[model samples]
Target: MLEIEQFLHWQRAIGRSQNTVRSYARHLSQFYRWLAARGIVWDELDFRQLCDFVAVLTAGLPPLPSRCGGRAPGTVKAVSAAVREFYEFHRVEGRGPQDLVLTRNPSKLPRRAHSFLAHLEHRRPREVSRLARPDRQSAETVQVIDFETDFAKLLAAASTTRDRLLLSAQYDLGLRVGQALGLRHGDLNPMRRQVMIRRRDDNANGALSKQKTQFIVEAPRRFFDLYAAYLLGEIAHVDSDYVFVNLSRPPVGGPMTYSNAYQLIERIGAAAGIDDLNPHMLRHTHATALAKAGWTAAEIAARLGQSHSASADVYIHLASDDLAEKLRTTEHLVWREPQQYRLKGDGDGAR
Candidate 1:
């Protein structure tokens, strides 16, 4: 527990954005509980045992002495990665003269080892993880709402301009909940109609950017309209520098926290008669909307402020009729517009 606490503090000191530090703290806490329940020493785990931990997570089993189900593969992988970092950090710090044996480097392994390649159908290097569930977030796809219907309902149901702006940030700008809440007034560029997502560790609400570096995202014209209205109307009296803050609620000038966003969105969802609506679902809707509008996978990733196209791939779902027509025309289904291909392999210039 002391080591975990130290690791979290060091993460913040080293300029890890607030969201990442929170994730490391949150997941490490869960891992600590699991280790306690199983009576397993975390620092003493061998590489194979660490992989087994990931395998157990992949299978959706609860930790010992608990009934809660497992997290998704991406989340589990994140936790695993954090644990590896924790061990490595302490090892390098010479705590217990510890050493990380996971050895993520592939160069250390023998090249073309026949015995190791025997059952390797996918050619995945080592047993570092079998938890690479590609569609791990596929459940989010079902939660997405169409742009014309449910998204409108949500916006219409919002009781205040502040809440409406929050929804717009997620839907129109494709911001994660943390990213939206972390926004400061300085990040908005009305002249350019862009919002800068700068990586930072400071926020009164403990909000943080998930992005490692700064990037700007284009915002809808209507979003800025609402932003102006919110500033003059609902949020005018708030004393916070954050773009979004508590307006009518208590502690009225405070930056919006994750819990505040969650509860507010849930209330808005109920008012709209939309069940289980969440902030992330709005982001999901944004990505899917772009896909429907012929945005390529890379374009979607850029719009979402994600670095990997694979992260954007899950949202490229097509209807049966569309798939059938595309398959009929060509042997493969193409999601990008033809011109988007010429933009690929060039930098993130498309962004």
Candidate 2:
């Protein structure tokens, strides 16, 4: 445990956010506990032991009291990363074996194309190498919901002004759920119509941004109206600094948790007849709308607080489908049937 403390201290010393340090600690603690239960010493950890640990995690064995179900691919990948980092730390400190290895393969195109144009393009194909470490599975394509239309329905279905504002922040300003929940009253500048997303280690209810940098996003005047109404009406007596809070009986005046936000969205979505509504989906919907409106990749990235334009590629890809549809629709407009020619009937006696 002292070693684990040392590792966490090292992480913080290097400027890792508190949320990140906590995640690393949780993942490492789980791994160490599993090792202790199996009588596996740290010095004995190797490739085979790592594989077994992954299998146990993937299978969710021994049935932990919390989250006893099988882990998702993303969860498995995160756990793998934490374990690898822990081993690497010990190995660097000369306190553990240095032979541990983790394999990862690069993303590549598949051999068979799903479309004729893809086959004709002759994209380079790649196969998994037996010697390489297994790569994480690709994430599912971003779902493109009609933000302007669906968001209206969501807002209409919301039971309170707070829920309506929460939905609006994510869709209008492209905020992650954590960012939206982390907002404070002072973070808003109504005169400028902008809100700041700050990075703080003490926000127990909110996760820090991936980039860990403070940035501002435009919040329209209408959002300010809803925000003001929520501030002075629903949560007027609450003393919390968090912008969003629970209005229910059990946890009134408490900061809203991710689960709380998810359940609220789920209920509202069911009421609105929308499916799989999530905060990130709203972000994606916002990005797609921006891309369709002729925003450059860099501009979209800046608005979304992404570090680079590369992350905007998914939105570009989504817009490509729209472009294809437009091309199909305009085909007749750009193309015309050639005029047919008729021979003159009065040409004297033919040649």
lDDT per model, in order?
0.77, 0.78
1-351: candidate 2 lDDT, tens digit per residue: 887887888888898855578779889878888888888887788787777777888888862223546775656667777777776687789877766644333354233336857657766534343222443344646576776788888899999999999988988888887788788888999889999998776776755665689999988887899998998899988988888888985678888877788888888988998876777778888888888777989999999888899887775545567889868888888897778886687556666
Specify the poorest-scoring 10-residue window by lDDT in model 2.
127-136
Clashes by residue pair, model 1? none
For candidate 1, the 10 contiguous residues with the lowest summed lDDT are 129-138
Q: Give the Cα RMSD of candidate 1.
A: 11.0
Looking at model 1, how many pairs of residues clash?
0
Which ranges in model 2 have alpha carbons more than 4 Å from their true place?
Answer: 29-33, 59-71, 103-158, 200-213, 239-241, 246-278, 314-323, 329-351
Please provide TM-scores, in order, for all candidate models, with all chains considered together.
Answer: 0.69, 0.69
